[model samples]
Target: MESWGNSTTVTEFVLLGLSRNPQVRAGLFVIFLVMYLIAVAGNSLIVVLIVVDSHLHTPMYFFLSNLSFIDVCYVTTSVPQMLVHSFTERPTISYGRCFGQMSIAVCLAETEFLLLAVMAYDRLVAICNPLRYSLIMNGKVCIILALGLWTFPVLLTLVTFLTLQVNMCGHNVVNHFKCEVQAVLKLACSSTRINGIIMVLASSFTLLFPFIFILVTYGRIGFAVLRIRSAQGRGKALSTCGSHLAVVGIFYGTALAMYLRPQAKRFTNREKVMAIFYGVITPMLNPMIYSMRNREVKGALWRVIGRKVGK
Candidate 1:
């Protein structure tokens, strides 16, 4: 990863960020700044709530704490930098820093997808195998799963980056904001055929496979829910799964649109807009979705607030 390509030395990349107009950039700066703050504060609160409350010490919240921590890191990976660049006249990221951010983003994003599938399976076991849920998803099992979920993505990212044998030849103007893998690939003077193959293989494991697994897992959960004779019981089952399903739909929808689309279509302004949905919107919405739908989370929030107020 030297900045030097074969012919020319490339030291930095100029980012043609989200907007060009000064007024538009100013407005975007304000809006995205607010979004960044809200996402950080909200996810941070979820992590805090899960940690401080005994009621949230179950396998589900343990995974959620991981999710919250990931979301905080995920958004922080790009948003703060993006915010600063938004208002600046010339937005640039160093060659080394650009790939550094991309690698971190990949690790966090892929880990979130894998963690979501694990959460779905957790819900399935809890709902379908209620009698042995605790034993099945015991403390040791949860720890191992969390470790795998986090570890696999880091390796995937590292492998993906190492395999990208790209030569820039001094071409370094990135069209979109941030160092998105696709956008960077488009700048390669060398053939990206090998890089494309590697990315597709990696995306299959990180995005497509986990998405299918989640769908199948949820299908079984749906069937099990239908067997519940009581309407209340059925509703409870759906409520438990609903929050997770909603998050999955938003995440996978945006991600598939971003990664799995026909590669013939080059990275464009539309792609940058699409990236915001998963990159910014989903992380902001995760805690709100879970807290609003989950009574336990709401209860924990109140109890924590009550203690502070009482003191």
Candidate 2:
């Protein structure tokens, strides 16, 4: 079936992007480019510090390194193209590339959600079962978890492709800057009920379930903190969990808002803006939050810097 308003099978799509005005586009280009650069550098530094510092060889840092890596990959998949499109006239993307972006971006994002849940569990074990933490989160298990985090996204890509049928009508103008899944799907001439259903299920599994897990895990952690007799001990315990909680709050808040919204009709421009904020803004902010709130990470970073100076 051909698209209702369009006649040709869409081979490529023209992204209308955020602005049509040259001045505004140029300003946005500069802003997003700077944000992308900061995000890459910040997350890259976190991964490096985690890998190089022996003191950070614990499970928490290991998971954090993976999270940083995913953040870098996630920002790269989406932001660079947006920057390019901001400058170019009538920015367009091929059908294949659009899905390619969607695959990589979604995979990275969902994997982060899973990773965060695992991190929450790690925190739980560290706090609640401090004596048995080592035995419980052993080297072998960490390796398996890392491998699973890396591998599941690939499987998700395949499942997403096979299950969803999207036949785009001739309407090839994508509303957002990049080839977002929702926006691209809107071009489809055929019914998207099945796609919506699958996305809802996938969203529940990837986003909702993990979110609930984090809440419950943290709730227990909060109670565990309160049980400590000394105020200093309680403070230390809460501080340990603070940075992760902050990061989770920002990442999940924007993401849940973006993905969980109804897709029955075309999304508003405000929704598009929210997508850009989370896709670009969150990555840049995560490193800052960790550095400011996490003392150990700061120490590792300073030690790394000192080593460079000494050498």
Each model's total of backbone clashes: 0, 1
lDDT of 1 by residue, 1-311 (tens): 33222324666888898889989988998998999898999999999999999999999999999988998998888888888887788888988888788899998999999999999999999999999999999999999999999999999898788767888877788988889988988887778887888888898999999999999999999999999999999998898799899999999998998888667536799888878888998889998987656889989999999999999
As for candidate 1, its clashing pairs are: none
Off by over 4 Å in 2: 1-8
Best by lDDT: 1
lDDT of 2 by residue, 56-88 (tens): 899988998898888899889978888888878
Worst 10 residues of 2 by lDDT: 1-10
Superposed Cα deviation of residue 154, candidate 2 (Å): 2.0
Give the top-scoring candidate (TM-score): 1
